[model samples]
Target: MKIFRKLRLQELLYNKKDKRLATAIKLMVGRKPLNLSLFKLAVKHSSAAEETKHGIKVSNERLEYLGDAVLGTIVAEHLFIKFPYRDEGFLTETRSRIVNRESLNQVGKKIGLEKIVESDLTEKGFFTHKSIYGDTLEALVGAVYLDRGYYFCRKFVLSRIISPHFDLDNIINTTINFKSKIIEWSQKENREVDFLLKSITGSQRFKEFTVELKIDQEFFTEGKGPTKKKAEQEAAKNACEKLKLAI
Candidate 1:
């Protein structure tokens, strides 16, 4: 059993296609019995290899498929219990926003998934891309579910992966249309506003995009985040609240 497991790990680690992903597995599942193949399969983008020699292609799409279902079910249960009064539409939209690629990417980057998981080879850059990282995160969940029983997997996901960073209330309510509110307030005040992506720090996945909001050449506020849109929204929200233009 031990030899078989080690061989499987060897195959996953030594394979040219999957070699670049060694660091990612260690970063996320350190000291845990978490099967490394699950993560490798998770990070394998369809673009990496269309097919293997035996006429089988490795891709995270299937894992992603399973992950999508798992994520929806978990989030649904959380919502159902958390907000007994929330209608189906509200719960669905809220879950959608939380599990969407952009949001998942933000979560992954916030947790530093990119730092430990990356391709040393310049051959592919999906590790640092949110579109892929987010998808892979989902696939990883699927893999964990398969390796471990549902209860243990669910517990790990809830306690470690999903719960710490996920603030359902803040996500649902606080991220209101800050930009739109700023625009309306600016119009009311007869002032023009601008949001510029000034500079960017960090990689594409864990990036900190800097944004500057100016009103009629006067700098209103500055903000930074993983996405330009998010930073700009922060700047806008700050400007609005500070100026008492809009709530």
Candidate 2:
């Protein structure tokens, strides 16, 4: 009797929590969630991850990885169909502009992820990372894929996320080659520019590269990414911002 009563109480508590989360999802995604636990896990940040008996931490990271692939595929297909005459390079660049960290972060905020995400970081610290919301957005995509299937997930991404937020023409027209801009500025100003590889970390499958940007042999900014070129691009973007060059 005691065990039965305890289990009943736990179920009731879970149901209550699920109810609240379901309401939030309906408002955000325009549909009621069928599997509430997936959505719950989607909002959980790595900083607030729970460890199990096997000493493995559980968070949104795995889902984020899955969602990243799915989102990329969906975006690639959409761009391909939308621009039949465009070359592969244009499709890739346009897709990057749509799915990049900064763009996703802004979209996440616009969709009210700030109120829904679960994190241990303070308000200011939470906002400082910039990637946290974007990561959560990807996790949410994974959850949607699992709960509603691929076709539904694609529709949600296109109708709810992409169509509402992005202006395709504007994104296509915008060129953001910060590395080229910085190099040109350096030449015109007669300043030496360099990108130095600082370090490489992480496992073989998931290596992260850190690069430092220097102008006239002085440290301007540092950036980290999955590849040296990406890290250098990030560093260059930061340096361009500092120099107030038109991006």
Q: What is the C-alpha lDDT of each candidate?
A: 0.71, 0.86
| Pairs in steric clash, model 2 | none
| Candidate 1: regions farther than 4 A off | 1-31, 115-130, 178-247
Identify the candidate with maximal TM-score.
2
TM-score of each predicted structure versus truth: 0.57, 0.71
Model 1 over residues 106-210: C-alpha lDDT tens digits? 666666656534333353554344366677678777877776657766776677666887877777786578789988987887999999889998875688999
State the lDDT at 1 in candidate 2: 45
Instruction: Write one digit per residue (lDDT tens) for candidate 2, span 1-247.
Output: 4474445443355566677787888887777666677898999998888999999998999999999999999999999999999999899989988997877877898898888888888878765655888899999999999978899999999998899999999999877777898999999999999999999999999999999999889998998999999999899988876764643
Off by over 4 Å in 2: 1-14, 177-213, 216-247
lDDT of 2 at 226: 97
Count of steric clashes across candidates, in order = 0, 0
